[model samples]
Target: MSPPLRNDRQLSELNTPQRNRYFYGKLMDVLHFDLEQEYLIAEQRRGNRLLLGPGVVCGLQVTVIRSGGERGLRVGPGLAIDGWGRRILVPDEFELLPLRLTDEDGVPAPDDDGPLPRQLILSLCYRECRSGFEPALVPDPLCDGPAHSEAGRWVETYALHVHEGTAGDVVRECMPELGELLHKGRIQEALCLLAADCPELPADPCVVLANVAVGPRGALTITDCLPRPVAPTNRMLLQLLICLNERIEECCRHDTVLLKVGAVRLLMGNGPDAVLDSPDERRVIPRGREPLGFEAEFTGAPVDQASVVMDSSVEVLRDRTPVTLPVAWPAPQRLRCAVRNALEPGAYTVTLRGEGPAITSAAQPPDDAEPLDGEAGRQWPSGDGTPGGNFVFSFQVDR
Candidate 1:
């Protein structure tokens, strides 16, 4: 017996089953796209967690449509990732996604009169159909198709406006403040941030399409039955930081503290070992020397892409008086700043903290928090109201 000539074709259409469990490999005698798709993202009922996206990647513009007697929300085209890393592409067609009027238990949606506010949500779902079972399953001899045709056994993954709610926990882990945002009825913002951060953080299969308050007599669905939203401690600390930073900027106008967001991320992933690379700037300079900068180096692994960035969370002082000096954070590894002009005779100090949690509104810093080198009378709300460790690094200039 001689070997048959090889051609490009999918073996799936050829045989129903060769041997129960053996997954025979193929070559140029061509393999179908199914094999490739399954190789990357297989349909396994049970396995390790698949961090999928229930979040939107972009453009699922939601609009409340009221066409004649019909009133429902329309979900525009968008791309949402699924538990299997599959891109559930929402087609560009207009789809009026009906509202769910009751909870999973068939209870009516809470009205404004109730203490518990109504929370409505939109979720992404996955639907699979065993396609190719139609009358066209058998191709005509004249039809221009593949070299061979397989009858039966085709799966088509569809975006079922309905959600299965099978996303892993890691989806919520990366975006710690997601629940709070959704609770605050800041659905759009939450979705946007989640989409923006998804690529950078980790693979998240859980995507909350949208959320809003339930209006009087508003219909509700089981998916809409989200847990009661509560403000996370860390989120509060971040808010405090924003508020205090605005106040400082508005009041003092001179000294600005830079929020080291990147540093915080690096600290989370790589461990917190950011330290001072250079000794404190303390030297007696000639009275008539040319203007120079006061630069300080900090040892840290390079994380941020920018060569230099401003981290305003620094307090610079020329002797006793406060002065504004833009600190250049090339990264935690090196924090440099040229002296605002020549290093005058006055003592200069650069006080900053490492990747600290969102500072809270505490009369006293946490026991583990490093004491501030600056004046005790002044308080800098630097976190999200959560109690967390603060790594203080105070560089002083003394002659």
Candidate 2:
């Protein structure tokens, strides 16, 4: 069975110059591309619209000529002749040739046959503002979402009107409720009304509220309700680095701290350290750099002044000032110098006794301390059983 003869009449009727122009115009509207350089040349058979190029149309004009012993298709003779003297008896061997024509010099011919460009139609839909609001700008909802161009125009007009301290009578009359709402604390509500009433109004109420809040003695707290934008913090600073280092080591893996009285075993999971050793232990000092102006006030009677010895080399001012001391004579006080330029970042135990005010012994577990587990962990204690009047240590560097 042979395929049906290919006819050009229907093809030509569908592909016309006028139809091609309209299709390209619609394509331009959809893509939002500049159409100045692009135009459509229709391959038309008659007056009706047909296939437009930059595209292809199949099965235009086809004729099959059967000749003796021609088993396959062949092309010969002139450029106008296709598959000359060949038989296309089988459906698989159907052959058709396309005839294409273009305007002179390969340029798209002018489309003056139809209505103007769709862009012109769009321009007519936009109504002009009144004389008083000569530079009024509003978002075109018909445009792509969040019309940025229209929003920018609104911002400019708003700036001008705000500086002038007057919105024209028409604007004031049309939006009396909005004006009243602006004076009140209802900025968001006012913007909603403005957007509903004026299709071209900008969408951001915060900008409008900011301009209104800047006057002398104006209630600027309204601006606080507006969104508070924030910038990222510097997480790589020295203080944060130290805190994170200790927290990761203490919590990610089990470790034990030793004191004179007993040992504390700490395990890591979520929400700070899990105290596996004792439940009574509470976090007295929060982890972070301590603020200045922290003074130790104790009610107990002060002991006699005594010279103290430190296990680690003490950092003293050039003037040889005492870094650690007992409190003032009448009050039980301990004066410990702030940790300055300390290389090791961990807790240290400073043991104090009546032997003439000295760090009688300072202790920290060895760096290669065993992990807390069966048969491998070592017991360590960090403090005396008495909790009163213990010194807390911290260090930080400014970068």
Candidate 3:
């Protein structure tokens, strides 16, 4: 038969030997931090459920040797437990050192290195509930006294910041996982976890909407709500989508753009042509006179030689132009030139006159230009010049 479950609170009250040998046993050795370095430990068996908390807390549990000698593992400084139902356990071997490094106003004094007891400084500040044990240790520099104490305090502060930053990053990056928890009907729990782990998130409408949208699917596709036309009115939507996409990409493997783009396209497609004309759409698409030819003038500097290439529908009007050298000493490094092109009703190409570089025209067809479909619309360079930069311009041709 299995041993009876133990309450964490009661376990905390047990003497070092009893807690270590009888309570924890084999379970005590297995606690560890995940890839994020966040602590995870199995503390108590409450009924069939296993309780886990930060490694610092787990380390506080005493360990007893077979000879009955007990040793309490030091709960390293620089660790703190936050969130509801979270508890902190300090080993009987270690005691709290209450030397405040900062002034009463919370500002650091010139002598204030930071928080003391470098190892115990957790990323987050939390309440400490004493188990009514007498203080067994006092705050002192691990090495020498006073002078080194301040330095140690500074080190503690730095370590705490590092720990907190790391935890915050992990929490932010694991949004999808949090969302998954919510999807599994653990909404309140998920939110609580998020709040406890990442309190930096603002309580705003957008955050609420984002949480709801991501919660059920364990993912969020901003493209669904993204406007079709790229305009000022939809700028906020576009920015928000970009930010979300970046966050999702960084934190989880989810690609918001790929998921939502098709849906956005379909939605925009269903709208009337007039809607297409509206500047309020948020999609990333080229607009203007369909496939219209425009001259791109390069004026600031002098170039030894310049060339152009058309990879898309747009064509270069000028076949060749002289490389104008600058007149002054150390003459302007680059030269100004223009690619004038009147493309066929379809996309066309105009290669530059030299061996240097080429620029592709736009993909959009000109207003008066003819329409070419599929491969027929793409303009390729003839086999004369060497390819340097693949500066292929893109444009669209309307029928």
Candidate 4:
């Protein structure tokens, strides 16, 4: 009988040539990225792209040990890559240490006057890529389809020469079965093994971080991380697929942009605060008096015909009840409110939720508009980059 099929291979075989041209074209044209790095951070200063690769590059000064599963990994001070920043982070706990020199017997050896040269193999596997953000463009079969394409293949032996730790420092090694499962593109299975292990040793062939390549059909480039399944391991993989698609949508839709509130201001009269002295400071307002004023400013992506909504509420600390605030936008994206009629005496927390129109080009219908047959539904704008976020202020209203 034949051996059972692996997930990676099974997926690759399922690829069809269905085109997702709209999203694919936007990603290709709007963003400039490299097919090598795990994530690309556009550098405003140099106009050059910085590559944030996966795995730690330990040099000849520190020692790294398997810290145990999901708890935290340990590294001696040196140079290390920031997973989110996609850049080199400095010395200390988050830093990468130098590689330990070792002798043939797997003992730590004295470092020679210079850095030692060693050849190491780095294994990598392709995960999955999602399509771009055009609501009109249907999901691409080449990428999101059930089958994987050539991109799913593995780079079993990526060779590199560098100073690294000797075998002795590796208190625990990755499970052989774990590597085998991943080698065959059994991602979920490998994650199960990783989660089951106590001290998570470095899973061989960890996920690649910065490399993303465009497919022949203009789909966004994607490469999967090696199996290091932890709690969010599965979630991380799924999010990557979503990110690849959303990024494209973000590129094309400039009319609808997100608005973010960094802080909230309180003014005595019901008017916009020219300069809020203490944003976080809460003041006492008499129960029977003129309405107190509140203001919030925003900064985010540029947009045209942008309308913003600030949903706010004040909770009476005494009764722990919430009263909605009628906060309105005076100009474009500027939020203000006058609290007069319903001012109860007590400690309160004012929460604000800022929403902007869904991002779409002038050519597309408004998000609230109905969809046409076979056309993508309404597209909503996003906050600068985030869809929406919240801001809160605390103060007391007294008799």
Q: Which is superior by TM-score, 3 or 4?
A: 4
How would you encode candidate 3's per-residue C-alpha lDDT over 212-246 as one tens digit per residue? Answer: 01113122122111111111224455788999999
The positional error of residue 355 in candidate 2, measured at the CA in angstroms, is 6.2
C-alpha lDDT of candidate 2 relative to the true structure: 0.25
List the candidate 4 regions with Cα displacement exceeding 4 Å: 1-258, 270-280, 283-291, 302-319, 339-342, 354-388
TM-scores, in order shown? 0.30, 0.14, 0.17, 0.26
Q: Of 2 and 3, which scores higher on TM-score?
A: 3
What is the Å distance of residue 177 in model 4 from its true position? 32
Q: Using lDDT as the measure, which candidate wins?
A: 1
Candidates in order have lDDT scores of: 0.40, 0.25, 0.26, 0.36
- Kindly state the number of residue pairs that clash in model 4: 33
Residue-by-residue lDDT tens digits, candidate 2, 1-399: 112323323333333232224553464531232222112211322211211111001111212233452211111211110111011111132221110111322122344333212110000001112122222144344553353232111111111011212211111144778778888989999868855731221222111111112223221112211222111123324566889889999888743332122222221122343222332332232334322211222212222223233432222221223244222222233333333332122332222322222222222333332111111112323333232222222222121
Q: For model 4, where is the 10-residue window of minimal lDDT?
A: 370-379
Ranking by TM-score: 1, 4, 3, 2
1-399: candidate 4 lDDT, tens digit per residue: 111223332121213323223554465421222211212122310111122233344431222233332111122332322222122322444321232333322233565544333322112222233333332233346444643222322222211112232221213477899989989999999989866733312223222222223234323222222321122334565887899779977886555334444445555554444343343445555655333656655445332223322231222233356655665666654556656644556676655433222222122334522111111112222123435433345566565
**Which 10-residue window of candidate 3 scores lowest in summed lDDT?**
257-266
Name the regions of candidate 3 deviating beyond 4 angstroms: 1-58, 61-64, 68-91, 94-399
Query: Which tens-of-lDDT digit does each residue in 92-161 have in candidate 1?
Result: 7455434444343223355623332365455555444443543444454454254334334534334423
